[model samples]
Target: MLVSAAMLLTLGGCVTMSGDYNVTAVDANGQPIKMVMTSHGSAIYSSRNAFCSNFPKATVTIRDFHTGEELKSESPYHCR
Candidate 1:
């Protein structure tokens, strides 16, 4: 039992999971302005809130982390 626990602990540290949806808000120059790794569109969804409302014109791009493809075309996040 002790050996099993130790082996599990050692391997657990090496295991990792990648998110299906990765979103980031970028400025006109394509510089990163914000990030949301947990779910799709969360970054754009929160743009109306206090934290993201500051960048009214930032472009939010959602991408497939496994494929490196844009889930959709970059769109401007309007605070209004």
Candidate 2:
């Protein structure tokens, strides 16, 4: 029983879940833009367009763990 309990604790600690983000931005039209995104615990999403119907015209970039990756993306062009 003790061994099982230890194994459960270890497994639970190893389990990591993704995070959620409610992102908002502004488009050229001056409107509010919102998107719901799901992160893979790595703090990286495939692309902004994947989450929302419209994507900002501003330069968008995504990086890996080794590289510096921006967690959130927003722009006036998107909300407007």
Candidate 3:
């Protein structure tokens, strides 16, 4: 049973996307909020002016390591 559980845990970890990268959203007050996103592969580390509120929105960009192009991005909502 222990071995099975361990195997399940390992498999779960493998199925999960890379969580090493993250994006943050700031509100009008400049408060930080965490975002959940799968890596889409982009070179941009950050994007601004994404928010439509009084404050600007920021996104953490990722790129495919091999192609050096956009992979994915995480945009945390602000004033929502």
Every model: Cα RMSD to truth: 11.6, 11.6, 9.6
List TM-scores for all candidates, in order: 0.43, 0.28, 0.25
lDDT of 2 by residue, 5-66 (tens): 99999887663435443333444454544544434443433444553345444333332333
How far in Å is the alpha carbon of 46 misplaced in model 1? Answer: 4.5
How much lDDT does candidate 1 score? 0.54
Error of 3 at 12 (Å): 1.6
User: Candidate 2 lDDT (Cα, whole model)?
Assistant: 0.42
Clashes of each: 0, 12, 11
lDDT for each of the candidates? 0.54, 0.42, 0.41
Worst 10 residues of 1 by lDDT: 42-51
Worst 10 residues of 3 by lDDT: 40-49
lDDT of 2 at 54: 58
Off by over 4 Å in 2: 1-18, 38-44, 51-53, 58-80
Ranking by TM-score: 1, 2, 3
40, model 3: CA deviation in Å? 2.6
Score residue 15 of candidate 1 by CA lDDT. 29
Q: Candidate order by lDDT, highest to lowest?
A: 1, 2, 3
The residue-level lDDT of candidate 3 at 6 comes to: 96
